[model samples]
Target: MGDLANAKNGLNIFLNPLYYGKINDNLKKQIVKVETTKDSAYFERIENEITDELNKRLSGVLEDYAEIKGHVSSFQSLHGTISLNKASSLDMVHGKWATHDDYIADWLSGLKDSIESGRPSMMQKIFKIQRIREYVLLFLERDFYRHYKVRTKDKPQENLWSIWFGSETLFWGLLISPRLIEDNWENKPGRIRKVEFGYWTIGHVLKTGLVDPENNTIYKFRDLNDFLIFYESILKRVSNSIYEKQIFAFYVDYIRKSQNPLLEPLLIPEFRYEGIKQKHKYRLDFTILNCHTGERIGFELSPQSTHMAISGIKSKTQTELNKDLALKWGREMQKRNEYFQQYGITIMTFTDDNLIDMKNCFKAMEYYLSKRKADRQSVDELIQDIISIK
Candidate 1:
């Protein structure tokens, strides 16, 4: 494996059998060889199967998972894979192997429950296992042939101890049968948090990657330090008002305190609007992407000095200045509404009054920082309001 470190914890995905549809012929030949030889040697089997030819085949199939280091975890080591294999294979003899149909039926039940619970991530996990079920059946079939005893004229009951292929199948089954994926999602650094497109507007905006407004180029940051370096560069070189800079200093402190491997608030400076480009289309001063929940919040630093300033006022009449002021105010409100409607961003403004107590202003936004939901009005309150009006 080239750049084996890049594959890292993602070797599980590379080893996923379903993704290698074209390798079915090669896999069938390996199964046949194992069956004829009746060899249960784990490491020997893997080393033999993972030949230069097989690796070439795997390269074509596993490019996506192998090359993408961000998709992998540092937690899963070679030792971990072997440990999982030993544990699962030892237990395989104690339980009856499920028929292919039964296995699929169980997966469908889990899929239904996941969907009803609104867990698309869990559904995806189930689907991955469900797709590779045929490979499991192939392994079972191979075992039946390999363990066949001439004296008994029957398949001898045996535990599967093959590390590479057996472990990968067991891993997929464990992921679906137990709540391993969900457990990792909540408590461990595993899958990169991916937002589905329909879930929120911010999903569509940052779907590709973060856009650097300074250069209008894509910037990929893997860690807090990467983001901080990019942010510091913008502050030193880009033109921002003193108030905005002060607010950003506070934001940096907040990000530092809240930063974690799983959940980090990305404060993108001057996040460009996804709406139609126009003179009125103002980039958000700061857009905080809550990676944990896929929620976006916009911080607008609207100090009266800059927001309400009328340029070339001395060159215009009183009526012209008033008209310009009205237009400017109109555009500001329109931009706020547009952001909310188009990007699902809760735009919070900090005027001079709000900036006077800037710490408290930022504090007020704590509620909208997570998964946002509309508070439902109670029937009792509705009835009371109706009676009071009469």
Candidate 2:
């Protein structure tokens, strides 16, 4: 009974619904239904069965309940710290925490500080779960298909052991769902050729006998370390753009935390201006509006890969033409800058190099805000300046 209790507690922490918030909404809806259902005998039975299997699996890997509780405690502490910080800060300022922008910069800043101070955060746990998920899916897809020939495409009965087991396990259900996988083929002149887009498929597992899609061309891993190396390489390739967006989100979060009624920051605001030729529209990455004075300051992030012509466009044949076009685009960007300056927009640009570190990113923004605060321009004067530019 004690062992069963420990197992239940451990599994709950490991597969908490909160961890799966970023997953598909459909999966979330299904999870809620399962959690809320009261009278379903099948659901209860399936839950108990999954619990028993997971307990048995984890007993082999985890040392004891202490380790599980440690992780759970860390997650709880991190969440509590963020909440406490927000509450305390809002109390100090005697202001309500507004939900208008979905900005929780103060909370995020607290979390980041905790993480940097050697406290555990969701990032570490997320990576651990991702590793476990990969291992489980690989084992199941390979073993189940090879031994029982239970392909998901066969519309396997919901009551079948394999289907029932997968559905009851949260991570398995999230990753192994039929809807999550897609197969693509290219129709060539003589024969159809398989063009890999790094998708998961049972066909690849069964036919090619490959354990992972990422290992198709590379040498197969004989040990855990080798598999981790392969996993990291694939993860890096897929997560670069995601990481860039996360950095942007963190910047927004920092701005939200520093929120003062006197100076409220707006994100990704659209500005309209008439060009010499036609009407032009531009979106600033972030804009700070001084509520007391009504002056606006804009900040733009220009990542080298996305914004700079030297790193962005890459075609051997079009290299010379692209350089010429890039110069033309540069001149247009200059004109936009001139227009913003004419209208008293006080635009500042930061490149990828400037945002390499989170601490540095916040510092740069803080410096800009300070400078803007010191400016003597009035809101009415700025408005008149904008009118004159128009």
Candidate 3:
């Protein structure tokens, strides 16, 4: 019974393929030991005990997998089916008829081999179960799904993506939040109240709507699509340079078409310092959060027009020109350094040359911006089992 308990530890290594290999090897070793033993009846009794426990555990796993399979099947018909080629390294035909037959053949073969060799043959079935289960969970737990879509009693029939953008008014209600006073200083008459205008997460914005106390406007958004339009409109209304417009536009369009739901689509524009008074209130052009890594990044488009422009009618000496040039350079570097020191944000500045090739400039940051899948962790018990056998 103690050996049986030790053997049954393999049951906990569900959905992990490498651990399944370890389990297969362990069972093989147990069979070898039983065959060589003088009093084989005792070892035979232990094998039977282990087999019964394994069967009971596998039965529970199968039942749970079946329930999840139904939800996943329904999800695929609405969105898109999981590619069978992704299931295994085996070359599967693109069509359903061919792939299904191939999969069944492989499953049966694996089972037969396991039975004949006194090893567990359920890895193939478990792998398939885990793949579809992971796919469904990814769809459900993704940032885009949580932020933009709502769980419904009845899911709408049409392609939800198409329907999302079909009408301007589609998801308006979800974004509506009550107007909040961003800044309320001492009630000194003649002092103008300032409302929040920059640097907000989509979740935060949805929870507490943007407020413009001066204009008496409260801004809300329904989905990521609506937020993009709002962001673009903000840039259009401001004095953003052509370089700023082009870079921002490309990033927005890229996220719109990409399937990676982990991307934070909107870059927070005109980011400002909060609850602090400074001699110079420096604000970032655009800021974004890396959802996968939880790193904050700042984008600055420094064209010659804005960054180097010096307006002075008085012509000064060589010393004056040097002083002014040094000051300008210092200011730019200070902004970058302060952001890094205070907020742990890395500022990636794009000059006129870099902005000219926006795609290439973005390529340098593609690693940080892209999706990062979670790494698989090894099971300690499974590792011990392998080490014991060796």
In model 1, which range of ten residues has the least summed lDDT?
160-169
Q: Which one wins by TM-score: 1 or 3?
A: 3
* lDDT, candidate 2, at 383: 21
Which regions of candidate 3 are displaced past 4 Å? Answer: 1-209, 213-217, 260-265, 275-280, 309-318, 364-367, 371-390
Model 2 regions more than 4 Å off: 1-248, 255-263, 268-280, 291-295, 310-329, 370-390
Clash pairs (backbone) in predicted model 2: 105-253, 106-257
lDDT of 2 by residue, 37-91 (tens): 5224534543454344444544332332224436434323433433454454222
Per residue, candidate 1 scores C-alpha lDDT tens digits across 267-315 of 4556556321223345777666553344668888888788899888789
TM-scores for all predictions: 0.38, 0.27, 0.46
Q: Show the lowest summed lDDT stretch of 10 residues, model 2.
A: 165-174
lDDT of each: 0.42, 0.35, 0.43
Ranking by TM-score: 3, 1, 2
User: Candidate 3, clashing residue pairs?
Assistant: none
State the lDDT of candidate 3 residue by residue for 117-169, as single tens digits: 65532332333343333332222222111221111011211111010010111
